[model samples]
Target chain A: MKQRTEERMDQDLAFLLRYENIAWYEDGVVKILDRRIYPIRVEHVICKTYAEVAEAIRQMVTQSEGPYIAAAMGMVLAVQEVKDRTKETILAQSDEAAYALSHARPTTSRQMQAVVNDARQVIRDALAEGCFGQALVEAVHAYALHYLNEKYQRYTRIGQRMEELLPQRATILTQCFPGTIVGTMLRACRQKGKEVILYCAETRPYFQGARLTASVACDMGADVTVISDNMPAYVLMNKDVDVFLSASDVITRDGHVINKIGTFQIALAARYSNVPYYVTGTPDPQHRDTSQIVIEERDPRLVTESMGQKITMEGVKGYYPAFDITPPEFVSGVVTEKGVLSPYELDRYFDE
Target chain B: MKQRTEERMDQDLAFLLRYENIAWYEDGVVKILDRRIYPIRVEHVICKTYAEVAEAIRQMVTQSEGPYIAAAMGMVLAVQEVKDRTKETILAQSDEAAYALSHARPTTSRQMQAVVNDARQVIRDALAEGCFGQALVEAVHAYALHYLNEKYQRYTRIGQRMEELLPQRATILTQCFPGTIVGTMLRACRQKGKEVILYCAETRPYFQGARLTASVACDMGADVTVISDNMPAYVLMNKDVDVFLSASDVITRDGHVINKIGTFQIALAARYSNVPYYVTGTPDPQHRDTSQIVIEERDPRLVTESMGQKITMEGVKGYYPAFDITPPEFVSGVVTEKGVLSPYELDRYFDE
Candidate 1:
């Protein structure tokens, strides 16, 4: 009771040591729980095909890039079951997976591209080896698992790097779902016995703060304060949140990091508040070109709909830019699976 | 409803002629039945002082340019009851009313400013007469009532111009409250034996469209259909909304219109959809330059707070930008009490 900071540090360290490997199989069946109804309702869906996957993605069930990438891998694997695991099947699956993933979350391009790249590699290896049946299936399975694990480790490394960027008891404001990286990083901080506090923005239209990230932080027991997106100026003025970490769907070669729709405003607020702001993600080759990225237009109802009884309609139309691009200048750093790099260092990974 | 087009024409004409003078006064203490708990708990508050008025205005109990202007007038009148109606009182009342009014809704500036203008005018008239006591009281009352009446007329004229522009049954998409103008216009059209249909946009965060404007339209018995703000593009692309009419907060001398945060995007959408769009409001005189129009910000929690069982803190923050400016280029015309002025004509009114 006397040592609140030490208590929090211990709790976070415990979460870091814990292994949460359920490997919930995607199976082309959209099995991710609908995040829109999280905490209130945990509903899992099975998306059988790429089309269904697209619908789920658009609907925001499996919204995070990690799960989205994982789902694409599952769908690619499902394609093998339907047809012979030929080179054509593998290549076609990669292409289809990429498209499906891109459409799932239009703002971020890396997840889809990353998963498809792994799938294509499996195809290339299989074609060169002249393998079929069990051998081909085994190779695909290994590749899928490898990509997912690689993503996790990249997040872990980024998390470690994030810890180094800030001090032991740094107050942090996080926007959007940073996913495995966030958990791993918080776990890392807890392990290091750091007294870090996360002031999370409850990303509006979708309260990812209260619904997803907050719940996760609560589970891991972090000193987390959930605030609305608009209150960043207040937080910066009142609370001394030392650092800001956000997750991105795409980090363009030009270093235009497209994350959640409200991230740019938060970054602007942070920069104004003199808080360091950073975006964390594994940048893919496809994400190197910002022009190639197509910003997804969300359903206007997402902006118009509210939680109410009798299902009242809000008569005013709303514009939901699913993600906003933060120019490299606003971003303090870009954390990837490889390492945490400054905005200027974006080119090194882009060329990778 | 035989001869559907004729019936619609009859309804539209009635909106212009018969419905302009429906007056609604607060029954002492009024509760803005929470939009989230509709058809369930009807929450009402007895608005006693300027603070109550401010709270109501900030919380959106008295929303829309008409009711907002009316509410501001009421707030000034209520504040005057306690203090001497001097220049300080007038400025303080206007300042507080404008502050609260600005926070009540975002993207509309005319209502608050209009009320402030009315308040300022009363103060000036009060000073000139060298009258204190009952005459001063009467002057305040007269000015407040006059502003409300003036707003009603301006809206009615706008509605009339809208009918002339569209002719047939018009489907109108409204953002927030346009006050009695919209309601009166619908009534006017019906009175003229014209038919018109209204489509309401569920203005998000506050649901001004679904809760306020829809109720007003429905009560007036206008043929109204409600749609989500998100679905406007689809609705405009598919359905036939002849013209789009949104209430603006600030209309600059250069004729830039500011409205709810999302109105700009909708204007862009309307332009793309090839539907004529109009921004309605009276020209503010105090601020000769649009830049001089003070933009008000509100609590941010409102955006995150869902309409349901109360959770989290007693009040999450709510970000309410009382009004946004819309540039003249996207606006087809400006609707005011004087007349429906072409966008180019806005300068004539501001020239004074």
Candidate 2:
């Protein structure tokens, strides 16, 4: 009965929301869907080694939760490369690969580190059981596939919980590309015959919201409109926005939600207008407060130019801080797989 | 002595801030500096008739205070075209020109209407005084030049008053192209040997901040950095932003400010962070409240594309409202030619 239900949920997801479509390891190579040119053109960046996969993450070929999955597949590549070597050599090389993949981007490093560390532990257990050479590689590869499936299942449940918290008819405002969870939530809304209007803020310096989120929502047959990052406050004040939802890169233990650069401004406007703001993600106990979160400042040229065409003058510098922190006061709740928890009551998430 | 001081101020202005550089009437043609491709390429859109000038305004060849001057020059073109005809014909044509120029764009219609009306009134007086043909054309032409000079002088005073309110050494955050007023304020700071760091939000859909404001500020020798519109709240929170300044399209008698779409978000963030928000513009007694303000919804294609390239998937819609409103409670003060006054105390301006 559980297997049938899981298969039904998998069939309901949008094309880009599926695990195999985002990134997959097969035939000793990893292929990641290139998000930069997605929806315009369907393509993938082929990675023969774990180093190539790490480079792809740094280049932002895939973003949001896409990187976390790519990091796990990268560890599988690392195991495949040295399957004929001794166990000690394979473990040392895999540790190096894990470090490189986690350090690809600073803002999402916490999740990426967790994914790679779990993969390495699986490899260690398989080797201690007297599995050598190709058998050990097979063991890690199987572990990676299972890890991806478990994450998808967890998010599916979170999506159903999120849909329950929403109204029967809702006008939603969101920022950045929220990845699979939003797609699953939209699918859940359709399943229940609920009406939803989505407004997406076109995240700048990387048109992630415009390119990634809009495409997925459009494929799911949801009513969606793309807005520039600056329009969130205007839309919240003038339009009938039932809720402001977003996916966070990391939520600190103190309940500060950090996501894209524009999320904080939206949270402020949402709070002022009495609209509740909710973020979907689990809390990172490593970050006790926002002070520990490292915001990645990408290349200023990305902000200064659009499609390789310079928007501003030659000498004027551009500032592009990849993310911003929204204090707990602005957040109404954090939706987790367990349930919707209050921002101040995050400790409830770890009680189990 | 007053004339010498005015000349010194003109010399101190940046090239783009000068009246002639923005828009001017010469050789029976009105040349408007094309703001859409400014700083990247210094070019002008030539208007051979009043109709062409009005069309230029609609197309956004010039913006902010630039349109006010363009509308005045357009009236000059009308007078010259019919100077050889009957007085009745000339007056009729001038009135028609005034209506067309003012109605070019809705948001700034009040200012444009006042400018063209003032020009027509000057023509009525010139004709009544027996000035005819070339003499009548010359009379209206001279009025336009004097009117432009008076406006420059008025904004110069507003700039000086704004400088007085700012700290000696401070960091300032601004949105959209503030036009000549910001240029003059920076000059005033330089004259006083005060340090200032300016952060410009690269306002999207038009990039008025990136292409226009940053160019002008850099030319004036101020320390300036261009950031995407989404980065304002982050900068306000993390950086030492002492003041948040912007230029408004119109301010209602109830103290509501209507400006670029992103201004309200910045104001909300500024108020939250205890940074005073100041806007430079005269209040319109005509608008009783925000309900009287018309927020122009522009073409969605403008927001969906960047540099003529589509950023999102096909079939997805974009929402582009050119302006938003900031309530009086969020505003710290309104900087006018008279002085900086409390938002609630706007009636003090008309006391004289």
Candidate 3:
């Protein structure tokens, strides 16, 4: 029944390119949907090498889960490039590819590192076992498939978990785009006969919420309203915001949940208004505390302009920190593969 | 000594069109510097009637103190329309002009109302004194002069008070650009040997902070860093933000201070980080409580695009409440003509 609902949700939301094959490695080439002009334009960045794939991630051709999935595919392409080489040389190239892809976006560097590195580990183990050429490339394909599978698994559980947290009818206040988490969650909720009203923040300097999240939510037929990031406090003050849910780039063992730039402000407003704020993700076991998490400062061109059109006064430099950290106490819960975990319960995520 | 520094700032920051005469009633036409294309293209809107002037204000051809000052100039234009008529008809036309201009920007409606109505009151007094014809037009001119002088006086006090608030070198966090207050304040601070590093929020949907505030600030020879409105919490988290100051649209008698949409979020972020939050303005005596203040819901087109370019996905709706109310408790102090007044001490303003 749940599987049928999921399939139907995808059908309804087909207008959004997010659910399509946005990133993949095929025939020794890496291709990604250029999300910079998403919905209005469907242009893809075709990459042939690891460096090209790295540049795609850096340029935000595909961001959030797209990068996570793309990096894994990038490793597969790296294997394809060195498929003619010896096992030792393939291992070296795979390691280099993994390192480059992970550092593409700094805030999610560690989490991304885990994805590419885990896939690289598989290639290394196969090489160590004397695997080479086409056999090693097949092993690389396995790693890409594994990464994609893990991502889907998390999405499956998270959407189901969130649907349970809500009643038959729910009003969700979410920040940034947070990519497809809210969209999938709302779609899954609808599958369960739950109605959702999503209030999204049109995350500034990027417009991710308006461009990305709203596309998926609206296309999926959920009731969605996009607001400027500034309006969160106003909505929380006067409206009935049932839950504040957003995706975390990285959540430390200490419960420092980092996401988009405005998430901290939204969480703070939620706390003040007595609204329950949530983050959808498992914690990163590597980062012991908040200090280990590096917040991303993007180029000023992004904040000072929109779609290459200069918006602000020229020569007025802008600081665009792409992400912010929300201290654990401010979070009501962290929706994970298991269930709604308390911020402190993030430590248990590593147990698996 | 203070006068010398002010003159120097005007000379240094002359590159920005903001410091020029932006609005004036010239030869029976209300000519306003078109703000939508500010700092990039210099253009003016020529309004020959009250409706045209009101539409200019509605389209944000002039904003902040520009509308406040321009609305007064608009009334003078209304008087020009009926210059050949009796005092009673001119007075009636002026009231109609005042009402039209006040509703142009709702969040600042009362504040704008006060500017136009105060000028109308001057016209009423002139009529009561048995003044008419050229004499009434002369009285209308006096009203415009009185308004310009009052705005300048408030600016002098605000800048002077802000000058006292800072140390020799301080990093100040500001929001929505808040107009020439920061420009004049930084100028006065420089005169007092206080070098300030201003971190401005590029208030989204309108880009006022970036286009208006930062233009004046950078031109004035002050070191300015423009950050997005999404960034206050991040800036306050690690940066040495000595103060968070913004201008209020209205400060109620009960102390609810309304300003740009993101002010409350910034204030909350400031409070969380223990940074002193201050608003530069005197309270409105007409609004007895928070209930009296009206929050504005602006057109979504402003948020969906910038500089005539569509930045977000098509078909995605946007909510832009041009202003947000910062409760008195969130405000640390109100920098006024007298001194830095406590938020609760606004009642003393009414007493005077």
The candidate that wins on DockQ is: 2
> Mind giving the per-residue lDDT tens digits that candidate 1 earns over A296-335?
7776555545442333333333445576667788888887
lDDT of 3 by residue, B1-352 (tens): 1333333223322343333455666677778887777667767888898778888988889777788878888888778788779877887899889999888877778778878888888888888888877667767866775666567667767888888889899898888757667767876887788888888887877777777777777777777788877789999998889999898888887778888888999999999999999898888878888886677777877777766667556556667777888888889989888888888878886565
What DockQ does candidate 3 score? 0.61
Q: Candidate order by TM-score, highest to lowest?
A: 2, 3, 1
Write one digit per residue (lDDT tens) for candidate 3, span A24-79.
Answer: 66677878887777766767788998888889999888776889888888888889
Q: What order do candidates take by lDDT, descending?
A: 2, 3, 1
Q: List runs of model 1 lying over 4 Å from the truth.
A: A1-23, A26-30, A47-55, A72-111, A123-139, A307-318, A337-339, A350-352, B1-23, B26-60, B63-147, B150-304, B309-352
Misplaced by over 4 Å in model 2 are: A1-9, B1-9
DockQ of 1: 0.09
Deviation from native of the Cα of residue B339 in model 3, angstroms: 1.7
lDDT of 1 at A146: 55
On lDDT, the stronger of 2 and 3 is 2
CAPRI level of candidate 2: medium
Among residues 3 or more apart in sequence or in different chains, the pairs in candidate 3 whose N, CA or C atoms overlap within 3 Å are B13-B219
Q: Cα deviation of A77 in candidate 2 (Å)? A: 1.0
lDDT of 2 by residue, B117-206 (tens): 989998999889988888887787777777778877788888888889878897999999988888889888888788888899989988
Question: Each candidate's chain B TM-score?
Answer: 0.73, 0.97, 0.91
For model 2, name the residue pairs that clash. Answer: none
